[model samples]
Structure formats: structure tokens, C-alpha cells
Target: MSTAAANEADAGGHELRDLVTGLGRAFGGALVFSLPMLMTMEMWELGFAMERWRLLLLLASSLPMLMFLSHYSGFEATWGWKDDLRDVAIAYGIALLSSTILLFVLGVIGPGMRAPELVGKIVIHAIPAALGALLGRSQFGQSDEEEEEEREQSYGSELGIMAAGSLYLGLNVAPTEEMILIAFRMTDWQSLALIALSLLLMHGFVFASEFKGSEATPDTPWWSAFLRFTTVGYAIALAISCYVLWTFGRFDGLSFSTALGVLVVLGFPAAIGAAAARLIL
Candidate 1:
């Protein structure tokens, strides 16, 4: 081969190696994120028993969500939209494979299991597992520049991150009856207090109650940041909570006031997730 051809071959080989490494990382991430659900009897039952339409819809929605996650933080650093699409595909594939291996080892699957049953089980669990793969690099990778950039992120960028984080974390809790139950017990005054608490906690973690590496950027006025980041972050969290509740059929029989209370209840954790997103994501 000519020297140029040999160099081309070398570059291709390096790219192949990187891709393999990235997939390996994604597999590990999928394990960490999916293990809990894989082991949970409730999750397994949901996988097997969930309505066909809901399951299919959830599976279909995961691709776009994964693509969005890949845009912000993925196992591989993407160069373009095509690259992000590719990474999202690979992340889901890794999720399927990792979930299968773990479930099989856990005795959740046996040789005699039917094809549709096996597929449903793996596919359902892989949703969050794949997302975990998409977010794994950001949580695990060590880069001072990335951390510094996150610390000093613009208000708009922080709002975007908060939205993503709120949605991501809210999904985990939204399907449960506990949100509605908690809402049922709380009075109107209590709901109002919860909202106020969510905003204050978001403010403290993101701007005040200083922890190392959690300080604000210079020239960021206190009240402006409070209004923009804290208030907006809580709003995003509350919105995500309501949307997830609706998507999961949790709002099917609820009255408006009851639904508002549920939103407030779930918004608490969603807000915390949003506040910690900058540090974590």
C-alpha cells in the first residue's frame, strides 16, 4: 500500500478503537443505572404487564430523548447531528445488551422465555439504562474545563440544563401513586409552602449555601440570578412534574386542585435534581 493509504488505514483503525471504547463505557454505565430496576419486582412486572400502547410509545419516545441527551452529554463526543444519532443508537444497543446480561444472571430470564416477553422486558428496562449510558460520560469524566464551564454557565444555558435534569429525574417518580397520595394529605397552605420551599432550596444549592466549586460566576447579581435561575428552575421542575404525571396516566381521574398538589409534591425532587444538574451533568 502507498504511504497515504497506510495513513488512512491507521486513522480508520483509531476511530474503530475509540468507538469500541465508547461502547464499553456505555455498557458499564447501563449496568450502573439499570441494575436497580432490573432487580426490582415492580419494574419487571411493569415490563411484562404494561399496556402495549404505553410501552410502545415509551420505547419510541426514548430515541429522541437519547438523541437530545447525546447532544449535551454522551459516551462519545459527537461532531455533528449524524454522530449524535449514531451515539444514541449505540447507547440503546448497549442498554439492551447490558440489561440482558444482567437480567439473565439475575435469573429474570431463562432459556424457555418467549421472544416477545424477553424483548418487552429488556426494552422497557433499557430506556433508563440507555439514558444512563448517554449521561455516564458527563458524570464520570474528569475535566477541569468542563467543570469550570458548568460553574460559570449562562442563565439560559443553566435553564436548559435544569429543564433536562428535571425531566430526567421526574420520570422516575411520576408513575407512582405516592405523588397523588401526598397531594391528597396536604392542605392548600401546605402546597403553597412546598412551592416556596422548592424555590428556596433551588436557590441555596445553585447560588448560596456555598460549597466548593458551586460558587456563582463573577458579575452575576444576586437578585437577578435568583429570579432567573431559581424561579425559572422551579417553574421548569414543576412543569416537568405535571407533564410526566399526565404522560403516565396519573392525572386521568384527578381534579385540577388535586393535580396541582401532585405537581407541587413531585416538584420538590425535580427542583433538587435541577439544582444539582450543573454539578452532576
Candidate 2:
């Protein structure tokens, strides 16, 4: 067999190699994604200019992260980034299209969207989903049967990671019970817990939806329908945020454009960070 296949087979035996490699990919992916989120928030909230050159520089830096994860110790990619990317492309396409239709039908979105802004939003958001799915697929390759099994095995890991990453990400914006009172208009510990609880519910909604019917076969869709629902719903929330521009529009100034670049550009890092943080850490 080819060297690639040999490594794939070997990874099954060498768990440490796979774990280490996955760790690299996941952290790399998270860094790529998180940077944009951090930058955008800082820019919008703090009134810093999101320099185009800075974005470019960040992109250039992300390639190495992708390559590193792509070439880590036990990462036996059956198909290169192309295949995972292809998966991402399909998933995001379906998501964006459906979400767009839903928005138009619901009348939740219009007026503020110029053609240019619409296209920009598409490129920005779609790229991150593509990267998230791609890196995740590459870092954690499994057949339909395997993906299902992984889903089951992933339960504990998922719960833990959600606690960390969600808390980490939310702290910057929502401020968990540990430190939320100073931020938004929320109350005490209960409110913070509820927010995290909602995301967990969202994740369960996504996983359960994917874990059903014929689609739940070994080829369980990467961008599962429920996953799409969560994303599209999130996107719609952002749209409503635009509408809220007239109301509590402070966050309208908060941006995620920076996080998008890091995330879309590097696939495995963010996914792995999430997985590792949840499971191992």
C-alpha cells in the first residue's frame, strides 16, 4: 500500500501520535478562528481600525498553522484539505442558501443589505464554516460507522470542551456568572448559566438531528442539517442585530470579521482546540 495508507493504518495503533497531531490541528484551528473574533470585537468596541494589511498578515500566518496540522504526526488524511474543504463547501452552500431564503420569507432581513454587503457577508461567514468543517474532518477522520461511534465517544469530551470554549468565548462578550454583572444587562449566575445551557441545548439539537435516520449512516453529513439550522439561526440573529441597530445596538459595533479570517484560513486548529479543551483538558 502507499505511504499514506500505511500511516492511516498505523494511526489506529499509535493513539498518542494521533492525539498529539490532533492537538496541534485543533489549537491551530482555534487560534485562526479566535483571532478574527478577538480582532473584530476589539476593533468595533475599542474603535480600532481593522487594517487590511493586518488581515493579510494574519492570513499569511495562518497557512503555516494549517500546514502544520495537515502534516502533524499521525494525521492520515485520506484526501487532502481539498476533500474536507469540498465537504465544507457543500455544507456551507446549503446552509447559506437555505438561511437566505428563510430570512427573506420571514421578512427578518432586508433594507440594510446592499448587494456588496450581502456578498461580503457570504464570503466571510461561509469561509469560516468551510474551515471549521474541513479542519474538523481532517483532524478526526472516520467512516460513517466511525463518525457515529466518534459521536458517541465524543459525548464526554463535548461537554467538557463546551464548558471551556464557551466560557472563554462568552467571557469576552457575555461574561459568565463568574464575571458577567459588569457587562451586559443580564442578572446573576442563573442568567450566565442559562446562556451556556442554551448553547449546550443547541449542540444537542444539532447532534441529535444528525444522529437520525438514513443520513445517520456512516456518511453522516459533516455539515449536518441540524448543524446548519444552528448556524443559520445564528446568522439570522446577527441579521436581527442589524435591525437592533436602532435599539440596543452597542454590539453592532462589535465585529467578528477578524475571527472569520483566522478560522476560514486554518481548518484543524480551532476544531482541535475545541476537542482537546473539552476532552483532554
Question: After superposition, which runs of candidate 1 have C-alpha atoms over 4 Å from their true positions?
Answer: 1-17, 109-117, 142-157, 208-216
Each candidate structure's count of clashing pairs: 0, 20
Off by over 4 Å in 2: 1-78, 120-144, 147-281
lDDT of 1 by residue, 70-121 (tens): 8767776665789898888888888888889888999998899887778888
> Which stretch of 10 consecutive residues in model 1 shows the poorest summed lDDT?
207-216
Candidate 1 structure lDDT: 0.76
Cα error, residue 43 of model 1, in Å, equals: 2.6
Model 2: weakest 10-residue lDDT segment is 261-270
